[model samples]
Target: MDIISIIAPMILVFFGYTIGSTRIITGGNEALVERLGKYNRKLEPGLNFIVPLVEKIAIEKTTREQILDIAPQPAITKDNISVEVDAVIYWRVFDWVKAYYEVEDVEDAIGNLVITTLRSAIGRQELDETYSSRSEINKTLLEELDKATDDWGVKVLRVEVQEIKLPDSIMESLEKERAAESEKQAAIFKAEGEKQASISRAEGTVQAIEMIAQALKGQSNSKEVLKYLVAQRFVDANQKLGESNNTKIIFMNPKDVSEGVGELLEEDTHISDERIGNGSN
Candidate 1:
């Protein structure tokens, strides 16, 4: 009976000790430990021992990555274009101590920070720049969030901008502007081509005129060349008149013909007189 009485107290203490010792799961986490309402060492994963009725856990936090979605918020671009943008953030707890006490709600704090940062970023850029520079903006947002949440023991992994909504009218106007610019460029190209063709034609005509002038100068004293030129002119005139379906009678001036014949005779007489004088000498 005395052995039973003594063993009872020991059994109760053993039971209490067994209850105090715990094994946290591998994928789980815990936080600051307090013994007798005083701060003690932090509890980690695996087996942990504590004094029954004296040690208690004050705050428990999970050290796993968390996903947070930011609600859509209105943003105004530098060009006065209003848009709605939403995003998501990936974060995890880096410091368990600060994560437990430094911030009231880490998720909520991060969400608000992201909203403000995105607003500021969008406001500084135009609409096109905002859309094209999303990657840069996301990098800046992650940096800013990491710095802001450092005290809270939060590590921001990445920020993703999900959607950016612009007004229908703005989209339509942008499309029209793009099309107009393309048309203007096409017109400029066409005008340039025409200008080049005209220049080439003018150059060719100038060269032809120079060659003709050279030939005329070389044969200035040839009556046969003059007759050939006159005959070609007459043929071209007749062809043009025939194409016009007009039967027009053309007459030559007798006086002009007589004058040309008289000049030829005078040239021959001069040549013969020169030959006779040489012979007499």
Candidate 2:
């Protein structure tokens, strides 16, 4: 080994070591360096330097928004309905050192935590609430997840429920219940309409009688005219009874009603002559 040969080999080694120690971290990314198998420092976006063998980039992660798709989980509601629920989580690694050191598998730990939390939340709510209160559920999940993931150096941006599936039989039963409820409401509305109409008809009948009495206010044949109006109303009432869907025993005979009205008018005997005179006119 002469001086030139030794110097040439040392120069090559230095160049190789310098090139190997340089690390380039790109946009929206970070790296965790571990010195001798212990946490040393975090590397931010852009060029970074480290000893080639003594310091290693333990983990590299994107600081930008990330998505984690949760597998479908089985849960039972308070109503005892079995359902499969799946969701997507928006999250990002805020601390690369904690994310790398604190958990064995960050993604797996988050997924399991979400699944367990969901099961617990769903178990407290009824099936109807689970379907109707999707926004509330998502809000609640986001809050819980954020709190739980704080120590893991993860920030949960949002939680979105992707799907909720129930058995076909349960769906059919819910449909039938909805239809039955609609029919019940319709029937109630119909009955109310009929009741209002009947009340209006009764009020009209009273108003008609009052108008007739007023028109014959001082007429000589007023008594006879009133008797005729009463007799007509009796016949109308009987006709409605016959038209009704209900089977009814009508107690008042139409002829008897007419006779009673006629006899009552006979008390105003002088009106009989007046009625005859008006008829002739």
Candidate 3:
């Protein structure tokens, strides 16, 4: 019975030692071993053996990729505009030893670094540029963060600027400015159209007068032709005035218009005859 008791204790001790020393590290995870509270070596995934009582795990961390979300924070632009900005950081631990010993808290350190860098980046750009140059800002963040966290054994894969918000007053002001610009453009277009139409009408009148002069030149009844044209134009003018709702038009006798055109044509013919006589002499 004494031997049986002794053998049972031995079996328990052996099993205890074996179970305590054997560590099953899951995939995508790593652990650092320390001897006497000092960093000794890093244990890889799968079956790992450590000397119990003399060795202990200092830190265990996942090597898999991680996401760090930065909360929305206030930043000032180069134009002296205060704005809110937020971002997301994709990172993963590459060297477990450096990640554990180099920085006290990897996640916290990265987050703080991102805040500082983001502010600096925003300070270099104006408010309008901040909205348009989001891709540039994100690229700058990734480069600077990747460079800064190199020693921490952390790799910053990508950075994205989520949203940029403007103050309500600023948005309202911009909307007003855009509306004013649109109205100004519309007015200018209308004025140009009216001006073009007036020029086209003037050109048409000049062309019609030239065509009539050419047709009546060297004709025996040119004076009669002029009288007929003047009477027709006066009748057309009266017709247009009668169509209007607001015009107070005075009607003139057609015989009076014919007499006036005949007198004007006689004066013009006398002037031409005098010019020809002077040239011949």
Which one wins on TM-score? Answer: 3
Q: Count the backbone clashes (under 3 Å) in each candidate.
A: 0, 0, 0
Please give the CA lDDT of all the candidate structures: 0.76, 0.84, 0.87
Q: Model 2 over residues 1-281: C-alpha lDDT tens digits?
A: 59999999899999999889999998899998999998889898898899989999987889888899998899999989999999999999898777878999888999999999888888888988998998999999999999999999999999998888897898899899999999999989977886787688779977876677667656778767776787788788667757757336366765676566456545545576689799999
Minimum summed lDDT over a 10-residue window in model 2 is located at 261-270
| TM-score of every model versus the real structure | 0.59, 0.69, 0.71
Order the candidate numbers by TM-score, best to worst: 3, 2, 1
Tens digit per residue, CA lDDT, model 3, 77-176: 9999988899999999999899999989999999999999999999999998999999999999999999999999999999998987777788898899
lDDT of 3 at 143: 99
The lDDT leader among the candidates is 3
Q: For candidate 2, list the clashing residue pairs, or say none.
A: none
Candidate 3 TM-score, true structure as reference? 0.71
Q: Mark the regions of model 3 whose C-alpha exceeds 4 Å error after superposition.
A: 2-4, 128-136, 208-281
lDDT of 2 at 107: 85
- Candidate 2 wrong stretches, greater than 4 Å: 1-13, 35-39, 53-55, 127-140, 160-167, 196-251, 267-281
The better-scoring model by TM-score among 2 and 3 is 3
Could you give candidate 1's per-residue lDDT for residues 1-281 as a string of tens digits?
A: 69999999999988878977663534467667888887787888777776668787787777888899988899999999899999999999878778767778777778888899989988988988988999988998888889989999889999998988987897898899999999999989976876686578658745653454345443445445544444454465446546543245465654464356435545665686788899999
lDDT of 2: 0.84
